[model samples]
Target: MLLKEYRDYFKTELLPVYDEKEIDSFFYITLEAFHQMKRVDLVLKPDFELDGMQLLQWETVLHQLKEEKPIQYIFEETEFFGLPFYVNENVLIPRPETEELVEWIINSVPEIAGDRKIKILDIGTGSGCIAVSLAKNLPEAEVFAIDVSEKALEVARRNARQNEASVTFWHQDILNTDILSETFDIIVSNPPYVRNLEKQEIAKNVLDFEPHLALFVEDHDPLLFYRKITQLATKNLNRNGLLFFEINQYLGKEMEDLLQEYAFENIELRKDIYENDRMTKAVRKSYS
Candidate 1:
């Protein structure tokens, strides 16, 4: 079939479930992935043909889309910080917000770009997204990552290896124990903070497809993971160390209060691109 014909087919087959915007993006991205091509390729080669087998592959992804499964889950891979990483239902697909958090950490902290070595720990590293990105960017930092799920850790380990980002992966629950035993110059987390009350606000694509273990907390105690990991930072962070978190949008004040309560100094909360109060940074008191 011709490329135009395939585009029309995508618009038709996908229109019932997705609006024009989503349909356009899904059709463009799916077609590109299948063809080892890009949207510009389609624009330049409008007459490109889809062989029978390729059409079948596209149709399969279309069927999965109709079922509301995420396209990223369908592709099983994504790009972050210009590096490729594998993802699955066992781990949450890396999102733009987390990317902003990584940027915030990379920009805010003192990443020794030359010969100096720095220690960085990523608590609750999901797909190893944050850890791998930091490792890729900060060549002089020793990046360590931890996750509670062995399966998730397996995926994270592979991501580290795939990205060639020399991160240490540990399958330990941050809340249960303090196996780290070493101090870090920076400790960061994008832990589960979506309270049960906010679950309904999450889109169906996320609620039904993504792992709940990595996305939620009970409404009664929404800051459970944050509180725990922050406490861990207090014990495990080096003097003059920085702690960072990508918190729930609504909990900025609460998170700030918690950080202040712990005697953390120079607490700062920053908004993400969408102007939501999303990321935080605090420093432990400097020891002479």
Candidate 2:
């Protein structure tokens, strides 16, 4: 089928389920993924046609889209921090808010002396997006990541290799661990902060298809991971080391309170581009 004809067909088939903007995005993404056709190529040659096998691939992806499966999962890959990452049901898809958390860490590195090597740990490192991005951008950082799910760690390890970032991967669960064997200069996590009660706020695509094990906590104990990680940080981080978290938007005050109770000093809660409270940073206070 001609590209223009297929575009129209996609709009007709998907518009009822998705908005015009999302349909456009899905069409372009599928075109590039399945046919290696760019939007410019489609515009220049509106007669660009899909072969029989290509059309079959499109039909399969379109059916998955109509079922509300995430496009990233369907493609088995996504771009994070300008680096490509392989993703699947085993790992949670990296979000833009977490990218802001990463940028915050990268921007603060200028204050640290360049010659001093730093050790950093990422707890609950789902796809290893945060850890890999940091290792890639801040080559001086000795990055380590831990996750409860070994399957998730597999994807994270692959991402670290694919991005040429040397990150140590661990299969330990943070919730059960007390102190890490080695001290870190920085500790960061984007753990499962989504409460069961807040699942209504998430989209059907996420709620239905995304890995719940990596996205949710009990509604009564929404700060479960935060509290445990904060305690671990106190024991495992160097004096005055930094701790960062990509938090749930609804739990900004609670997160601050949790850090305060743990005596982490200089706590700062920051917003994402959308102006939602999405990130927090705290320091393990130094003492003479």
Candidate 3:
């Protein structure tokens, strides 16, 4: 079957489920993943063809898409912070807002000048996106990441190796731990902040296919992870150390309050590209 014909068929089948732009994105991304063909290649060779097996593969993906499966989970990979990461049902696919959190951390740190090395930790490091990205970009920092799920940690470890970013992975559950083993110069988390009541607002693809363990919190206590991490920060963060979080947009004010209650200084809440309050940063009080 010709690639162009298949593209049209793909679009038609998915038009009811997704918009034109998203369908095009899915099509080109799958084309590149499965056949190593870029959009320009398809345009150049208008008559490009797919063999029987390739057609079968595309058909399988089409069915999955129709069922609202995430393309990243279907492909078992994604790009975050311009770095390749392997993702699966065991971990949540990295989101763009979280990338913004990473950038905030990277920019907040001054360049290391001497033998001084900064230590960083990522709590709930699903897929290790934040930790790996920071390690890749800030080569001088010693990065550590922790996840409760062993399977999630497996994916995170592979991503660290794939990106050639040196990160230490821990399998401890942060909620169960009383204190971090070591103090960090910076700590960051994009932990489960979505309230149960907000599940209806989530897209079908995310609601159905993404790991809920990494995406949700009890509606009664939406800031569970943030509170615990902030408490830990008070004890485990170096003096004047920075803490960052990718927060639920609706709870930005609450997040700031939590940090303030913990006596963290210089708290700042920032919005993502969409102008939704999605991230927060605070400095550990020098006296604490």
Candidate 4:
């Protein structure tokens, strides 16, 4: 079938599940993935045709889209911080808000960048987006990532290889471990912060498809991960070291209070592009 006709058919077929814009983009993305061609390649060669087998596979993708499956999960890959990562149900698809958190870490730790061996730890590094990006950007830093899911670690390790980023992946449930003995110049996490009570606010797509092990906290103890990680940061961060988090928008003040209790100075809470308080950066008092 002709490419234009296929695009129209796919969009029309998926329209009930997705908006026109998303369907069109998914059609283009799926077409390129199947043909092993670029978007520009399709433009230059509109005569490009899909064979019967290719059309069948494309149709399967459309059917999945109609089920409200995320396109990123279907493709098994996504771009995070401009680096390509392989993803699946095992890992959360990296979001733009998390990208902002990564940028915040990179910008806050520029002084450590020129050093040959600044230690960095990424707790709950699902898909290794934050760790990989930090490793790629701060080449001199020795980056290590920890997660409870070994399956997620596999994807993260592959992503590190794909991006030529050097990172040490560890399978440790952060809530249960004290194995991290060395101090780090920067420590970061995008841990589960969505409270159960506010879960109704989440879209069905996310609640249905995304990994809940990485998305939720009990309603009564919403800052569970933050509390756990901050304990580690207080004990393990180097003097003048930085702590960063991608927090729940509803718990910014709560997170800030927790940081202050730990004596983290230079505390600053920042909002995402959406104007919600979505991230925090604080410094442990440095005397070394």
List runs of model 4 lying over 4 Å from the truth: 38-47, 111-116, 286-288
Ranking by TM-score: 2, 3, 4, 1
C-alpha positional error of residue 115 in candidate 3 after TM-score superposition, expressed in Å: 5.8
Please give, for residues 1-288, the per-residue lDDT of candidate 4 as tens digits: 997778878877877778888876887788678877777887889887888988889888888888888889999989988888899998999999989998888777775545557899999999999999999998888999999999989989999999999999988999997647677889999999998888899987788999999999898899888988988887888888889999999889999999988888989999998999999999988542
lDDT for model 1 comes to: 0.87
TM-score of 3: 0.96
Give the C-alpha lDDT of model 4: 0.88
- Compare the candidates by lDDT and give the number of the best one: 3
lDDT by residue (170-234, candidate 2, tens digit) is 99988889779899988999999888888789999999988899999998899999999988888
lDDT of each: 0.87, 0.90, 0.92, 0.88
Off by over 4 Å in 3: 111-115
* Tens digits of per-residue lDDT for model 3, 1-288: 899999999999999999999999999999998978898999899988999999999999999999999999999989998998999999999989888889889898883224688999999998999999999999989999999999999999999999999999999988888998899989999999889999889999899888899999999999999999998999999887999999999998999989988899899999999999999999986655
- Once all C-alphas are superposed, what RMSD does model 4 give against the true structure? 2.0
What residue runs in model 1 are displaced by over 4 Å at the alpha carbon? Answer: 43-47, 111-115, 286-288
lDDT of 1 at 178: 59
After aligning candidate 1 to the native by TM-score, how far in Å is the CA of 262 from where it should be?
0.9
Using Cα atoms with residue i matched to residue i, what is each candidate's TM-score against the true structure? Answer: 0.93, 0.97, 0.96, 0.94
